[model samples]
Target chain A: MFKVKVYVTLRESVLDPQGKAVTQSLNSLNYQEVTDVRIGKYMELMIEKSDRDLDEVVNEICTKLLANPVIEDYRYEVEECVAQ
Target chain B: MFKVKVYVTLRESVLDPQGKAVTQSLNSLNYQEVTDVRIGKYMELMIEKSDRDLDEVVNEICTKLLANPVIEDYRYEVEECVAQ
Candidate 1:
């Protein structure tokens, strides 16, 4: 089995309200030096079949189902690397 | 500066659509053994202050803003240990 981790976040130029709220709260806690915050989702997936074809499969999953390409960008890493 | 990380996830019993969708995608990727998944939010905060008052402030931030206690739960750790 292989372990996969997926992280999804809005494009850097996009505004994040949830992040902003958290930053403001942090500032109030005397953490005023913090100027920016971005919130994102993390997912861990366990794959049973990883026969050296991880990249292709992970790409297909990310593009077709894991993330919305238009609004968010996703990056994933497998516990072990598979050749192209 | 100090660092604080906040993780928010649906309560264990709550159903997570994002998690389910990812799990299904993984299954199609030949990761059939995967049966469950959970998606969560992570926030990293950089604080300027590293005094003994970190807990009081961190607690205030979590309860007041870091998380919506009703539906989300958050856990945070200070880079440096702080006394109660």
Candidate 2:
């Protein structure tokens, strides 16, 4: 079996209010050394095939379901299945 | 700047309808080696400082805003960000 890791993040042009809120909170706590924060989402998928073309499979997934191309960008990697 | 990675997936005990749907699709497409599929989300956070303690900061964000801890478990890493 193989494991796939997908990472989704906002396009740089977009604003992430949720991330900003956290950054603001941190700043309030006197972590002045901090300046900015952006939040993103991650996903893992376990599949039984590795012999197939992973790049094509991942491309199909990313465009079809894993991400909304309009606002988010996603990247993925496949590896041998290990400890869930 | 430092980037944080967070992953959220359905707790092993819960059923992932979306993942099941994908599994079914892959099977229908004749990818017989595939047996199961689980989907999770990934996120990255960009911050201006790494000099501060990252663990505590990430914990606070995960608990307070980034994720719903009741149903999700997350892991993160800090690295010198090379791109947006």
Candidate 3:
């Protein structure tokens, strides 16, 4: 099997209101040292070994379903794993 | 400054309906090799240097704000970085 970990984050140029709200909440809670916050999504996928190229499968999945290309960027790492 | 990356994930025993939905969507789209999916939150915080211990600050933030200890687990990595 293969273990794929994907991270999807907002584009740097995009406004992240959710992140700003979290930052304000933290500051109000007395974490004044926090200067900024950015929030993203993390996903773990377990895939059975197949003839398809791992990178191709991962890239297609990220582009099609995992991220919104216009506003989000995604990257992934794949590792071989022993299925339980 | 310190760059902190935090990952908050559902506890192993918890049900992840969002993940299950995504998995079903993928299977319908023909990515049948995918066996399991788990979704989580990823956050990045830029923190200014302070008198308080870094670990203590991070731990408190994770426990009090970033994660729900009853159903989620969190881990973080901190690195020294030059402020822009």
True contacts kept of each: 0.55, 0.58, 0.89
lDDT of 2 by residue, B2-81 (tens): 76666666678878788788778867876656577777665566666656577887787777766678876766777877
lDDT of 3 by residue, A22-67 (tens): 9999899999999899999999999888889888988988899999
Candidate 3: residue B59 lDDT (0-100): 95
Candidate 2, residue B58: Cα displacement in angstroms equals 1.8
Q: Which candidate leads the pack in TM-score?
A: 3
Candidate 2 error regions (>4 Å): A21-35, A50-52, A82-84, B21-35, B48-52, B81-84
For model 2, what is the error of residue A60's alpha carbon versus the real structure, in angstroms, after optimal superposition? Answer: 1.7
Give per-residue lDDT, candidate 3, residue A52.
Answer: 92
Clashing pairs in 3: none
- Candidate maximizing DockQ: 3
For residues A36-59, write the lDDT of model 1, one tens digit per residue: 677877776766663557677667
Error in Å for residue B71 of model 3: 0.7
Point to the candidate with the largest lDDT. 3
Q: After superposition, how far is residue B72 of candidate 3 from its true place, in Å?
A: 0.5
Task: Supply the DockQ value of model 3.
Answer: 0.93
Candidate 1 vs candidate 2, lDDT winner:
2
DockQ of each: 0.36, 0.43, 0.93
- For every candidate structure, what is the RMSD over all alpha carbons to the true structure, in angstroms? 6.6, 4.0, 0.8
